[model samples]
Target chain A: MSGYNEYFDKIKLNEEQHQAILDAVKKEEALLSQAAENTKQKSSDTAKIRFMRRAGLIASCAALLALVIIFPLGKRQSMTPANDKIPEADTVMSSDIRSEGADASLSGEKEVRTDAALSPQENIAADPGSIPAPAEEPVASIITDAVIPNTAKSDHAFPEESDRSAAPANEPYECEFAHSIEKSGEETGEEGPVLVEASVSDGLLIFNGKSYRYLEETITDESAFDAGCLAVITVGGDALLDPALLDIRSGMFLYGKEPYDRLYIRLSEDRFLCFVPEDN
Target chain B: MKTAEEMVSAYENMLYRAALSHTGNCEDAQDMVQETFIRWLTKRPVFESDEHEKAWLLRVVINLCRNYVSKKGNRGNAELLDIYPAADPEEQSLIEDVMSLPAKYRDVIYLFYYEGFSTKEIAEILNTRESTVRSQLLRARNMLKGRLEAEL
Candidate 1:
């Protein structure tokens, strides 16, 4: 090993080679520092872009939150005055009807107008007997007033004392009037007779290519007849039944069940359009 | 830590010789030495002593020379023969014989003999087992002995 070391020791670089290495090292050092500076600048720019993106996202979220809080309050404030004007119009209409000399013979109608002027709960409590039974009341006039706005009567009818006493004692006065009043609230289009293909199966009423699930049988307490037909069946299914289909204006109380286990809609007194299921 | 200029001044010759021993080309050797000093500038490795610093520099130069030779393929013995033109005929022949050995044997022989490192130190420098260095050293010595004897 010592002898091999003596031979390798003689192998050395000359003066010219030494100068060449020093020159190369100086040039390489300058290039390395410039590259490091450029890398530092690029990293700082990337950090600024990331921060701005986060700030933009936060600002957009804040704006969306402000809209969500403000919109509902604005809608509720706008709706208040319109609701307050309805009772004022009803008072003005009752006054106009009373001024007509043609209605002077209608004392029963004057009582109904006075009752209509009262709030619903006060009218219900003050004289429960004043409300008319469904049979004694003309179904056409009620349907015309509630379902067809243009043909509505100028003098609303009220059943006389003799007619009220003649109606079955078990009959519900509120349910018949309440259903008609509820139908009146809807914005119905032109009234025309509609013939819809209908059937009932598994508690679903299928009519006009649409199926309605039986939400409930509306007359739960009374025997079916005293409630005036076998329940006012409400329409419930995947979608609402268009009220215009039967000139019913409202789908809620249009369906009735007779003694024959058939579904029928009353068009007027002594007239019912019955749905005979296809299977029958 | 030394500045890049100070490190170049201090360790360039030793690194250059070690690199030349592996590469067998003065230009490649000088390039390897410059690259090793550039690494010293960039890495800025902390060392316990000047001996530690020298060993680190030597390891980097040897690895650079190895990669340069591998990428360029095996350098010719004819080019290596010109490395020692100033020496006597017998000395030049001996130096050429050392350069002619495979790179692994040349590394062990040079580190163990010229650099005067122990087998343990050579193992650390080469990143190998000390026993492997001893065996390579034995094989290198036998080859050199056979070549020198045949020439005589």
Candidate 2:
């Protein structure tokens, strides 16, 4: 063989070696096929696991709703209109009410008492400790007129002394807010309910969420207020400083120590929604 | 319509040989051949003739083998090269010398002499002009001849 051909011939495989190469090729092909199959199965299993997880999430949500319906406590009443009368409780419980075990009947069936049909008077009388004096009298009277049996209305269920004391009375709250907001760019002031989630610095109320600091001079109106307090003016949720009652929205600026002497800005409406603690 | 079975059967040996020339390992050569066959089957190239089909398969196999060899590194991995020994004194020395040569010259020599591809075929497979292929082959031959003579 020529020098060049010798090199080529040297590189060439014998029959046995050629067969070995073919066998290797076949083995590699089988491996690729196995890898492809494994990938497919893995993808399908992953999809199934994801689907099951989603279904579990939905089922858990449904179970939580069912649990809420199975238990009831009287705390803050549900704000929703599903119930006609508020339970006579300082704190309204959630909707579901289950009766504790009663003696089994001859038929061995459980007896359950549903709270839905209870008269307002009965519910209120059941927990006199929960009623607020004076503030709840009118509401209780309305409930008596609307829900009590005719004979029960004539019977005084509330202590007569409690009746005299239950009339609504005006409660005044001195409002003060720590003004802490970084005041810059077209000055914006928020007046209404002061947020309790705030830190108060020397004559400045730092809004808990908003990082703003305002000067006491910028408070155009002033009124009676306490430090570290938030007054939730019922109407339009106007939380503001008492001594500095400036209607920043109307562009009306009041200047004086008794800034609150200016007409109390009713919520959006001219009626008092209620004075709630800033924490509320 | 070229079928995968026919293509695999027709060019399997050629692809294996080309991969062996590039990787100098029976296992990697086999992988390159299998991969090349798969690529060919997937692309379903409409070859002008059997020669075109063979050349395309060999080109893919060589390129894949080259990539594998480089990724594995050419030095200090005796375990891989031990499976497939060089065929003769000339061939073994040629492979060692080519392996030492820069990849550009080694590619041309492997395609031209070991693979038995003409300069024109090499040019077509390499996506270069025919003149470039001819010049490359001449340069590769000279480089290998010099290196082999130096070894002797």
Candidate 3:
């Protein structure tokens, strides 16, 4: 091929094209070098991160999870003092009605008198203290009543006024929160209504698989709410009392604490079921 | 150690021209030049000598151009025809004629003659045997002689 050297030389690029490629090479070289330096800096920075920093990140995630488990929301967590985890019965249990032997049927089937268990009006006629044998019968009937809230509205079967076991009108709540079990005997709701599973969706709080819309701002973060403890709001001295909760909706939460506030159950950090007390 | 700038200066023209032989256009040729250097900077392969480094750059250029050519409907070098218009008609004819040769022969002829590579060096760059390169060179010369004689 070199026999015609001049002919092959003509195929070689001229000055301008040669210099143009050189200019492009210079431009690309600067970009590549900058990119390489950036990669080196990133690698060095990543290598310099301490092991303790990674450990601290993991520890933070663990702590967040632990806090999520401990606190029942909807009440003020930051404002409510940590020491108030356990509140006095009289201060929080104001205006509640208690019934003993309510869950005695869980022990075995009890023979309840259908006649005496008719209504709240009928239960008031008997001296409940004198008749312990037939009390389980009416209490079991109350459980049957609880199952059918969607069917018929009944006057609250507050344990008979004559029953000595009834807590004072001031003493209402039979607290059964999961947290209170280890600390004290407060969560032992021997006389409380059997709590059924309930969930909140949109504005309606679903209890006993029936939907009832709340009359007020009951839930803040609805996603955090699980099935709340089932309790009926019944008429008390001045306001409707949620028998499941203490009057002071403090460390835990309630849907409504105002008079005639119905169906207030707190399951989460900032969510509740607020129903109109008139509907109950 | 040669700086990246020094390497660019040393190999850019040869790589660009090598790319041009395959692409037959300046824009795609410049693209291959950039791609070859980018691979060199990122891969940072240690070279045994200047010949090894030059051969590596040329091989990358050839590979990049090969990919460009193999793409579907890639017969795109109309701009390359007018690039050397100021040259005399015979010089222009010769450049056009060389590019018009089959790619394998054109590559061997470019390395053997214009770039002044030995058959061994051309073989190393193309990743072929030196004897195969010599045969390719002879065939390319024979083909070029006949074609140019007819056209000129």
Candidate 4:
């Protein structure tokens, strides 16, 4: 391409010049390799960070699940305690009345509560002859054929007098309560109602091998009863009968399994009326 | 497909020659080549073929040299023989004459004569029309011939 071919040949790189360019290229190559290595390291570090984030998310989910499972159990335990604070019995019949009527006075709570701790003799003096006449079929069946929802497992028990004696007042004791407070106090010649007397007349309603007799108590006090009818608690506190019309007065007998975890009334051979209390 | 070292080895001489045509000095040529490779490491552009890859390297070296020349603004300071200091005087004279030309003429001359790139290939490498490369080559050769004859 040039008339100066000889001249072009003369300026060709000598050994030293050739070596110098080669050395520079090699140096640049080394720097470039190091740069490549640094890039790989950066990518690897990013991947590790992503993995750690996933692991952290999983750990957070597990922690949330553990809290969900443990919280309810913890709350239920907090509601209860090692030592009992609740009354062993419901002589005030406040809960029974309260269920039947929302606006009933709490005065009965004070009256029964004072003598709640008293022995049978003291209970007789406190309100001797103060038994609300046991209406053959109370004036009105305030709580009739009322089947408490059976959502929870009932606190099961067989008839045990010791079980009913005294426990924490906060917890309701499901025990073998007597048939009628007045009738039991009468046998002892005491005036007012005390704890019910144990009767195994119709085979003990055995719960966990202990017998629980059905002590049916009806709250029919018109002023005290907002429903203006009667509310009867099945002896075992398993059933209540609330009749919409107070005039239709009929009592339902308690019948269930031997352990009596649930109570059922045989309406007939084919039909069965069953219920579970709310505070099981 | 090429490792960093392989790419450098494969393209270094060609890129060096193109950069030397642009800057006319060994130092600036080396700087251009190194800078081009540094860009390669950073940008890592995708290439369709080996020709595309080589064209990319050549383009980068040429651009870097062009930028170096404009920033330096002392194009005449480089005497080709003095830049490399060849052991042979005739080669020195010829290279000095080539370097003395304007960068546009020098690029055509280098790619056409020394590198044996066709007018069309040189045009593609320099991003110019083949006709422009042809005219530049003719002008470079005429200038070189006149200078050599006078020196003789």
Candidate 5:
């Protein structure tokens, strides 16, 4: 073992080799330190990028939330009319007119008699304490027109006839009807006109279980009608003698003469009826 | 933990000699020693005593040399004798014989004879059982004895 020790002990590095190892160790340490510093710098850059991305996402979300909150309020503000702030009497009169329009058939005769007994100005003068006079002439005229029935205003049954004689010959009379479809047939029975079921299918109007080709020019707009409802067919504002059926869903009213006469149907606020000719 | 210069100065020669015996070449042995020091610098292992530090360095160098030899499939270089020539013919012959031994045998012999480690300490350094180290030592000795006797 001593002999083996002596042999192994003889093996030693020269001065040059020892210096080379020291130099290599120094070089490696520098490289490692530089690598660690670069890694730390990369980590910092990554963290900054992540923070900016998160901030951008948060900002986008906040902008969307602000739009969501503001949009509905803007719409509501636009919906309210600027001229809605009227006097108390005008407001009451407008409300009464709307109620009368709702139940016009039941109480229409009584309102017409009252309006006939006293003029708008005479009524305000006679019952100055109970009824206040309208501040404006246009407002007073609107109240008179709403209260007075078409039959009371003229001898003719239809208001369009009176409108043609009173107003300019070129101007057309526009009638604004109530937003209700009255089922007259079942309720009135034999006393009044019977309104049967009606439908429009494939460019043909199915009325009283008979298909009739309606005038194409009369159909100003295409409106879909619902089922299981009764409607009356009116000619020159008068119900047909045979009592034709019409499906008046969506507050629709079908009127006008047949056999090439103009038909009027009111479906929506912006849309009106297309007439059906008697020949078709 | 010691600085690179301190570690290199303290254990470089010892590690180099052990690496040389396992690697069988001066260039590979120096490379193994340098790599061992680099690891020591990077790892910064704490030691209780000088012996513990020396043992740790020797184990690292020996393991590095083993890995180099395994990867390169290098047995022994004939030029090993030229690097450090002995004064006596017999001592030179003994060195050659020791180098000629298997890597495991040479490791146990170097730690036991040159480093003055017990069989148990040699096993711990080599990460083997003490009985295995003892058996390897005995077999290495018998092979050396036979070669020396034949030469004589």
Candidate 6:
């Protein structure tokens, strides 16, 4: 053997050195085993979330059928010439509906309000089951809105017009949420720009091409069948998303992985929407 | 699959020795080994053989050490120095000589002499070309021989 080989051969490990090496290898093996277990656990949990989603959809469809029967009869009786003196009843009911809708949209509460304002004739002709069905077509139309235009040069012009239109006179304009009943709780507390209203047309929340935060709102506003739909939120619970800025046209998907994360949808000036893994 | 206890008894010492030579500290090396094992257990990718598993473990430990070193550098911390007990009176002098070598040379030499890794194996472990490993090994040998010869 060469002199270098002799020196290497002469080297010896003490008991402590030998013990340390064994410990490290054992630690690594244990870690790998644990990781495999975690993966199995996660896969099972994801399957459960998917099942719950399907059950929710079926329940909603059934509820819409019942609303058709109740709303028209109430509207006809409430609109009688003898009951015409009670205009306040209409206002009170609308406010109550707004409050109930707000509560439903704010949390994950279910709503099943049947608007009693529809004429009896209109109600008889309309299919309650199909009230929300028309909205589904708009979902397809919103997809093109998500496609960003090459506005690199015209970014200034668009933002200027958007901001000028939003300038407050005395009080901010009331946000008309499509399925909302109350203002966002965060909007009431903060000094920055607030989402006063969100308009729901079809299944999409139209925020007038502007950004607002849903710091206090839950994802997918209304829960029950034929209930007013609200803007769905996703992310760190503190931020808002700009609804109008999202190029949602008709049938655009609201939430997915990379598209949702990179959508630049800030519900509020300070908060941007985040994508949470459904499994989590 | 081996039981946790069997794995602990069989491989802990080897991993610790490898970690110690890489990091030059008992505590840091032990922590690195423990962390590597924890991560392995948590993120288990299937392995083909015992040898492959061993390589993967060693690779994780080494990468962890590199991260620690890089983080320390970012924080402006001093590099680790030699701290092992000398085997003899003459060996005490050799300790300073070996420890004073640059990290680039020290790593290959320690793996070759202490870990018993072949040049090609060391290169594979370090994710470097075999020619680079050979060149570094030659340079490390030449430097250590010169230092030992001078001491003699």
Q: Write the per-residue lDDT of candidate 2 for residues B1-152, one digit (tens) a residue.
A: 75455656666666665666556566676667767766764565888987887778767876786677778865421432355455667765655666566555656676777567888888888778889988877777788778777888
Tell me the tens digit of each residue's lDDT in model 4 across B22-88: 8767667767776787788667789999888987888778877777788887456256555456446
Candidate 5 lDDT by residue in tens digits, B1-152: 66788888888889988898787798899999999999987887899998888888888989988888889998575777787776688787888898899988888888888888999989888988999999999999999999999999
Q: Runs in model 6 with CA error above 4 Å?
A: A1-49, A59-280, B73-84
Per-residue alpha-carbon lDDT of candidate 1 for residues A76-146, written as tens digits (9 for 90 to 100): 65445333433442334344334321243354442433233455446446655444332343434443322
Local distance difference test, per candidate? 0.55, 0.45, 0.52, 0.52, 0.58, 0.47
Model 5 quality (TM-score): 0.52
Interface RMSD of each: 2.6, 5.3, 4.4, 4.8, 1.4, 5.8
**TM-score, each model?**
0.49, 0.35, 0.41, 0.48, 0.52, 0.39
Report how far off residue A33 is in candidate 3 (Å).
4.7
Residue-level lDDT of model 6, residues A1-280, one tens digit each, is: 1333333334334567546655665666666558667877777777777777777877786677667766787556533521332243234435654554465456654443434454323432453322211122232233233333232322222223344234221222222323222122232453322222333222123343433221111122222211111223321122233333343322222331113211332232233221111111
The chain B TM-scores of all candidates, as shown, are 0.95, 0.76, 0.90, 0.88, 0.96, 0.81
- Model 4 chain A is weakest, by summed lDDT over 10 consecutive residues, at A243-252
For this target, which candidate reaches the highest TM-score against the unseen true structure? 5
Query: DockQ of all candidates, in order?
Result: 0.32, 0.07, 0.18, 0.10, 0.51, 0.10
Candidate 5 per-residue C-alpha lDDT over A1-280 given as tens digits, one digit per residue, 9 for 90 to 100: 5656776677787899999999999899898889889999999889989999999999999988988888787655532321121132233334444553344446433222123224434534554443312223342233232121122212323224343234222212222111111233333464322224344444344455544333222222323322111122332121222323232222222221111123333232223334333232
The residue ranges of model 5 lying beyond 4 angstroms of the native Cα positions read A74-280, B41-53, B75-77
> Candidate 1, A13: how far from true, in Å?
5.1
Model 6's TM-score against the true structure: 0.39
The 10-residue segment with the lowest total lDDT in model 2 chain A: A88-97
Q: Which stretches of candidate 4 lie over 4 Å from their true place?
A: A3-43, A73-280, B2-11, B41-53, B75-78, B83-96, B142-152
Query: Can you rank all candidates by TM-score, best first?
Result: 5, 1, 4, 3, 6, 2
Scored by Cα lDDT, where does model 2 land? 0.45
Q: What is the per-residue lDDT of model 3 for residues A77-147, given as tens digits with 9 covering 90 to 100?
A: 53243123224322232212221233334446442221312332233234333222323234323333322
| Candidate 6 residue-wise lDDT at B27 | 67
Model 6: which docking level applies? Answer: incorrect
